[model samples]
Target: MAEVLFYHLDRQPLDRVLPGLLEKCLERGWRSVVQLGSEERLEAIDAHLWTWREEGFLPHGTSKDGHAAMQPVWLTAGDDNPNEATVRFVADGAGLPDPAGYQRVVMLFDGNDNDAVDRARAAWKEVKAAGHDTTYWQQSDQGRWERKG
Candidate 1:
């Protein structure tokens, strides 16, 4: 089963919550997959995630296969766009399908990316149609993680 946790805060910095959350995952030696957009955001999360991982968070886990230290995916809008179109873009940058295999899958989205917003909607649809259990995000006043059925 996948559990979704939403933190409602207006001024809480991403720098603060991410490290602790990643560390929390490390405290128990659980395998985690961190997915986000852009190198800047990935680096920000990596500041702490990498440290925690190196400190024996998960010795054999924490794979940074795609990007520097996280799952780096780009968002695209239309056909023949620069790279991919995100979840709705019908490109390679697709969101998670089954988050059941891992302990936690944390996705950090800008919540303002046009393509990303649409992809999030599509992801919600995919989840419902496929009956996958994962923490999905729906943009609003506060970031809400809607679990798939």
Candidate 2:
């Protein structure tokens, strides 16, 4: 079963938290697909990954960039996993992809947004019911991720 990780974002925005998470995936030698809600958001994330830091790069490309299979991190607004990624990052309220195809699934939602939080809650229940190994992580008072459930 795929591991489902829920990230409740309160201490920071997705832009602040995403790059670091993607970096960790790279360190583990895992390819990832970051699925957003729309192409505009996907483009924004694509730009951010390139300039998030002065000396850092995440090695990502969107469908518009072509050669999807060659990218370590593939960005898309759709459900396609052209890179055969072992890890999938579902952001901006995007629905989960086929869990069996991924080793891990990460859903990041804004805790400050009521709708986002509610959606995450529903997702957690659905994932758990689907029999995946699930975990819920929330940001602490000091802006650190803590395993809450």
Candidate 3:
């Protein structure tokens, strides 16, 4: 069964929190797919990942970059999983994909944004209703994730 995780981003922005999470996925030898709500946001993230760390690199690619099957991390605004990723990260208020298709589904939302919080709540209900193992995580003041549910 897939595990669905809801990450509440209040202490840090997505750009700051995402790279570390992606690094963890890589460390676990899991391929990832990051689904964004817009093409603009996808492009922005794609660029950000490239320079998120000077000494680190996360192998990722977008549609414009092609070769999806060869990328360890794939970025897209659509539902397709060309890279056959084991984990999916949904951000920027993007619609959730079927959790059954992945080993894990991570939903990251801006806790400071009312709409984002509302959407995350709805997503939590939907995923829970679908019988997926779900957990909610909130960032602490020191930028650490704390399990709240």
What are the runs in model 2 whose C-alpha is more than 4 Å off?
A: none
Candidate 2 — which pairs collide?
none
The runs of at least 3 residues in candidate 3 whose Cα sits more than 4 Å from the true structure, single-residue gaps closed, are none
- Pairs of residues clashing in candidate 3: none
How would you encode candidate 3's per-residue C-alpha lDDT over 70-148 as one tens digit per residue?
9999999999899999999999989888899999999999989999999999989998998999999997777678999
Residue 32 accuracy (lDDT) in model 3: 97
> How high a TM-score does candidate 2 get?
0.97
- CA lDDT, candidate 2, residue 106: 98
lDDT for model 3: 0.93
- CA RMSD, predictions in order: 9.3, 0.9, 0.8
lDDT of 1 by residue, 29-115 (tens): 443444444445555445544455455432212223333233222222212212121221121233543544433334443344566
TM-score of each: 0.45, 0.97, 0.97
lDDT of 1 at 78: 19
What shift in Å separates residue 93 of candidate 2 from its native position after superposition? 1.6
As for lDDT, the candidate ahead, 1 or 2, is 2
Candidate 1's displacement at residue 22, Å, is 0.8
What is the RMSD, in Å, between candidate 1 and the native fold over all Cα? 9.3
